[model samples]
Target: MQISDLPYTDPGVPDARSGPRFLWWLGRNQAGGQLKSLAWGLLHFGGVMALPYGVGFAVQAVVDRSGGRLAFAGLLLVLAGVCLAFGDTMLHRTAVTNWITAAARVQQLLARRTAHLGSALTRRVAAGEVVAVSTGDVEKIGWFVEAVSRFTAAAVTVAAVCVALLIHQPDLGLVVALGVPLVALGVLPLLPRATRLADVQREKAGKATELASDTVAGLRVLRGIGGEELFLDRYRRASQDVRHAAVRSARMWSAISALQVLLPGALLIVVVWHGLGLVRDGRIEVGELVTVYSAVMLLTYPLRHFEEIAMAYSFSRPSAKRAARVLSLERTTTGGPDAGPVADPAGGADDPRTPPSGDLFDPVTGLLAPEGRLTAVVCGDPDEAGRLAERLGGHAALDEGDVPGPSVRLGEAPLDALPLDAARAVVLVQDKDPVLLSGTLSELLDVPASGNVTVDDALTAAECGDVLDALAQASVDEDPMAAPITERGRSLSGGQRQRLALARSLVTDPEVLVLDEPTSAVDSHTEARIADGLRTVRKGRTTVVCTSSPLLLDRAERVVFVHEGEVAAVGVHRVLVRTDPRYRAVVTRETEEEQRRSGSTANSTDAASPNGSGPVIEIEETA
Candidate 1:
């Protein structure tokens, strides 16, 4: 494909049968670019082989005192220089294009798989391994793909040059041809050991990356529990292992590099010594001797491609294997690689049996959220609440030891039976701690919307006026809406970040919005404003919020209290609080302490914690 057609609309189904096959699949898809690179490489190396012949002819002409022949040699040298300049430029251009396109294809595929699998992708693969495949592994895969065409051209050039030499001067040609092949193939036997060392280095490096990612993701919790030094020491040890492995791999490659130099230098010495003998005995002209010497030097250049291609393959093979493994993963509900939605005998105009939109029902918990209403789910176990939220979003069976739950259904159609994108479009599950990707405010808020909520409205609904003000303050030179956010929104307070994340979810305006502890970080005052705004904006839309906050539950149209992993009761928030002692205990574990600290008439918006959310929420969750 041309460069303009990038970010491919469809990267096509990958041939993920094996690593070698996956690599071959990539090559076949980009045949046009590969062919272009190979053609240019041949032209470039063909010119490189001509320079020696021109120099030798010029030398002969000079010794014979032939002005016409020397002029012809000069003309040939000029032609060779032109070819070298143009061919080399185009060769590199095509090679780089090939590399970039291959990487882009893999990135697109990974992104698609990531979106489809959701959190389940991480369940099957290590976070560090995924990170490596996307970053360094991607570059290595591209490196090998780009190296193949150049290696082919180099091989052709070597063969062509050897044949020409044999016809022109058999004496020096035989030794030159034999020595060059030996130099290129001699390192083949050392490759298996070097590759093994490199693989070890890669494994250790991946583990270290995974450790760093985990530490960063939970740094707050680690600090709270005073486990920072414990994790830090573990990371240090992992990093040290990576360093040791890298050194071992580097040493082997260094030996290979040394051999590359030594073998070529030794071959050059033998050629020079033989040429000198031929010249002294008057068997060949001085000009022929010069031609032989320079040709031997030129052959050294193309021979290096053999070593480079080998090293490229060695690194890239593992990367391709890892990529293939990730791509091969399917959601258990997805059945297998070729599975699709099961067709219903009672069909409608639509192809799949998936319903357009309706109530979300979880049979395992007997929780039913009616269409065009807001429902609040209260469970004493925060972990259980999180898992139920995951199931509602069509991601099932993530945690172990939990009873197998029935598939959540939208109308009569099971959510798991629907396509991932279709399900995501209908149900938006915002976890308690949602991630805020680094971008401008506008970019962050630019999500698929139902045209029902504007950015201003969403921010207002989520009580994010202070969030906008903070962003504006940070980016004084730019528009407030265009202000840039730091990675994970770490620059903002936890409460402020939570409010912004709430605004983002509101912007999506999906058919079924599932929010887990959407306002746990916000103060009681802001939380009340958010509850009011959320109710007003989502007046007729189905919204499921998994939270124990009284303000939010008080605002919900209906409250479904789950007890012992089953729906124990369903009614208004006040009714549940008054009638259900279990639900009251779950929602009001620290209400007396919080009220005493903040005073009853102050709207429950405690001023003790600057970030809106205080230690009370955490204490209740743990209790």
Candidate 2:
């Protein structure tokens, strides 16, 4: 691939069975580029080998005292110099291009996988590990891939030099040739141990990175609780552990590097010693001795590449493994809904077996949300409610082939059986603590234009005018939409952030909106306004809100009380409270909390609304 064709249009499905296999896959993807690199490397190293031959010719010409031969040798040396310069330059160019292109391809693959899996990717892998795999690990894998061609060229050059030396003098060439293998193979025993140490260092480094990421994410909370020092100490210990591991790994590699130099140096001495003895016995000429010595001296350069390739393979193997593990994750369901309507067996255009249109049904919890109505679910256990919410989004199962027991059905069709995009488009589940990416308010609200709702309408429906006003207070420009938001919206108050998230979701206007305590961070008054506005704005659409707020429940057309992972009762807020004692207790607890906040009498409030909604207090409060 050319440098301009960076970021491969299609990275294709990766082979994730093992690290070596994945690396092989990468090599195969860019076989042409690799071949080009190898060709350039051969030319470059060939040029280097020719310099020793030129020196041998020059010495012979000087010994014969022939001006013509000396001039010829001089011309040959000049030509070899030009080849050396050109070949080395092109070799580096091709090698670097290979590295960058390989890295870009892997990055594109990672990005595609990340987008396809969405939040599910993080559920299986740590955020830090994902970051490391995409960044540092990708670069290391590319490094190894780029080094392969150079290593091949070095091996070929070593063989060619051995042949040339042998052609000159058999006995001297045999000694030099035998020493070549010793220089390359002597350090094999140290590789396994070095690889192990490197793995340990990488593992410890990943943990430290994860710790730092989470700590940075929660820095505000840490400072609020005066636990910054405790976490700092923990991070300090983690960093020190990484340091120790890295040092140990470096020491092992250092020993290997020393051997690489020492063994080759020893061989250099032996070649020179043996070449001198050959001269004394008249077995080889002085010019031939110089050529053999120069050839071995230059051989040191390529032999070192053996060590480099080994080190690259050792470091890159585990990195590829980590990247493969992340890429292997798949969504719970695979197939999307078939295009067009269901067809009848009689070959008619309309299918009688079409799914029925009605309430959203969950066989697991035996809960039903009436079509085109606002429904609130009050679960004593928040965890159970969250799980149910996930089921609504067809994410309860762990794999596509795994039977989704007691699956959720929308319009009579099993939700898990529908196309993933179709199901997600129909149902948008907003979590309790929604994340707000770093961007302007307008950018935050900029989702695909699938629904009719606009940013202004959603903000109004979510009652976020106050939130916009609060954010505007800090901006130089008065327009809140133009103001910048920090990562995760950390600069905003919890309630402000929650309102902004709610606004962003409302803009989507999906057919089925499942909100898991969207307004939990806001006060009762703001939540009351949001509840009323949410119902009005979402008219004629299915909305399932998982919450226990008496105000929100009162606003809902129907409320389902979930107990012990099952729907215990379903009715209006007032009727269920009077009929089901468990439901009454849940609403009553929220009522008392409201009463305490407002400093009002419980009996008076109970008599005022008999609906269990407590008093309608609309006092404006800053988030």
Candidate 3:
């Protein structure tokens, strides 16, 4: 499709078998645009090749002393000039259109693939590599796509020009014809080395970008732990490696550029020197000598396209390979012992479109939450809790090595077997890390929902009134929802961020909502209020909370104690705490920590404003 028709209804399934195959798929999809570009390129290069012929005819007309012929030749030159102007402008126009549309298509495909893979993408592919694909790699791929048409036209023009010379003057034509091929093909030997150097440069640059990204993301933590200098030193070393690799790649490309110029100049000299001898021997006229010299000189312009095409391929091959590699990551369909074989295309499914509604079951862990119940899972390790939470949402740790058991199913329908979007509509997962995107508070909370829970209801359920007060105190508008959240909600305290994220999640009100340590950042009183609010708001809907907090666990109808990665006890929270020693140890440790944190909070509150009405501004440091 053309650039104007962009944002395709479907970018279509990419043939990501290899780098070349992916590129070929892109070209095939944009065949119409490529053909149009080729036509314009032919028009432009044809006029250029005709210019020297027009000039030569004018010179011959002058020697014959024919006024009419001279005027006619001048008219031909004017026509060629007009053609050159129109054709050149349109060729460039079409080329850019091809480039933009191709890049847009690639971007769409990458975005779709990322969505399908979910958290698994960063696990399998480097974050910096994904960033590079979206930014630099897409541009390189588009450049190669746009260059193909122009390169074809230039190659054809060079061949046609040689054929014309061979017919007009065989003696000098033989040398010119053979020399043109030599000039174009001479750089072939240097290409393999150049491409290898470019690949090395790309790899080193990706590592440096990843390192810099990590350092920035954890800058606050590094400074707090007195480890900023350590990471900075590591990053500096990575940057130096990238710089060295870039220099090596640049040197190889520079050598290739030199060869292109050197070989073309040599060909020009040979054709000119030979043509001059033909004129001296009376084998050809003076005008014919000038014509031969002008043809060789003008041919250099199109000849440069050879080197450009080579360079474009060198950069884009790796880019296409990377894009293909990311696009090929399939969402694991086999979530349980009975999960059927599935397509390799990420998120693709041949299953029945209808999603079933019933109890949520994970066969691997033998955990079952009957439909319309709030179930609490007590896991000692936060890492294990996070993985369990993700699995409940159909995001198993397949990339990290399959942990045997867990294809979460809703009744008879397997969640992972469903299309990714369909699976998400069934279950929503919120991890301990609450990443609030930068935006107005209203916008941040605006997400796809079942509409069963309103914004006010969710905010109340999350016990975020203090968060609202914090926003209102900091805002010029005095409207808490209108207040802006800076990147990652860095403007808010840890507690405030957690509460706001809970509000956002509550707004969705999915069929099965899985929360991992949702209230860990908040104080005991707030956690108790949140636990009560959650039970009220989520009444008669399936919910799973992976937490050890007694406040939240006490609200649950049932608690499942998981030890050594398997179900250890299943009963009411109070009964398990009293009867199950292993379960009690995990719960007791968390209870002790919460009590200590509560004591610290009471001491801090005692020293606050005398009226106790003053807002307690808690940054992450204070929290």
Best by TM-score: 2
Error of 2 at 188 (Å): 1.6
Error of 2 at 251 (Å): 1.0
What C-alpha lDDT, on a 0 to 100 scale, does residue 617 get in candidate 1?
19
Evaluate model 2: give its TM-score: 0.85
Off by over 4 Å in 2: 334-358, 362-367, 377-388, 395-408, 414-419, 449-452, 548-554, 558-623
User: The CA-based lDDT of model 3 is what?
Assistant: 0.83
Model 1 poorest 10 in a row by lDDT: 614-623
Residue 90's C-alpha lDDT in candidate 1? 97
Model 1 lDDT, residue 582, Cα: 54
Candidate order (lDDT): 1, 3, 2
How would the candidate models be sorted by TM-score, starting from the highest? 2, 3, 1
The worst-scoring run of ten residues by lDDT in candidate 3 lies at 614-623
Better lDDT candidate (1, 2): 1
What does candidate 2's lDDT look like per residue over 1-623, in tens digits? Answer: 88897767787888987899999999998899889888888888888888887887789789878788888878988888888788889889999998999888889988987866655566568988998999899999999999999999999999988987887778778988899999999999999999999999999889988888889878887998999999999999999999999999999999999998899889889988988998899887777888888888888888989999999999999999998887776655533455334322123236564333468998887788989999999888887887788778765435323454655777766666655665676678887768899988888998854467878888998888987887688677878888889899999878888888888888988778899998888889899999988988899989999998889988998888877776767778877765455566677764656555655444344434454333222111124
Over 4 Å off, model 1: 1-11, 58-71, 111-131, 211-240, 272-289, 329-355, 362-388, 395-407, 416-421, 438-485, 507-509, 517-541, 545-623
Model 1 — TM-score against the truth?
0.73
Clash-forming residue pairs, model 1: 523-612
Candidate of highest lDDT: 1
- Separately for all candidates shown, the number of backbone clashes (residues 3 or more apart, or on different chains) is 1, 2, 2
Residues 1-623 of candidate 3 have per-residue lDDT tens digits of 66778798999999887789999999998898889888988888888888888888889889989899889889988888888889899999999999999999999999988877676577678888999999999999999999999999899999999999999989888999999989999999999999999999998888888888888777876887999999999999999998999899999999989988898899888888888888889999877777777888889889989999999999999999999988877766664455644323223245444445689988766678878999999886778887777778775434323333546778877777765776787788888875789999999989998799999999999999988898898789899989989998877777888899999999998889999899988899999999999999999999999999999988998788776666656777877675454566688773646545545334434323444223222111111
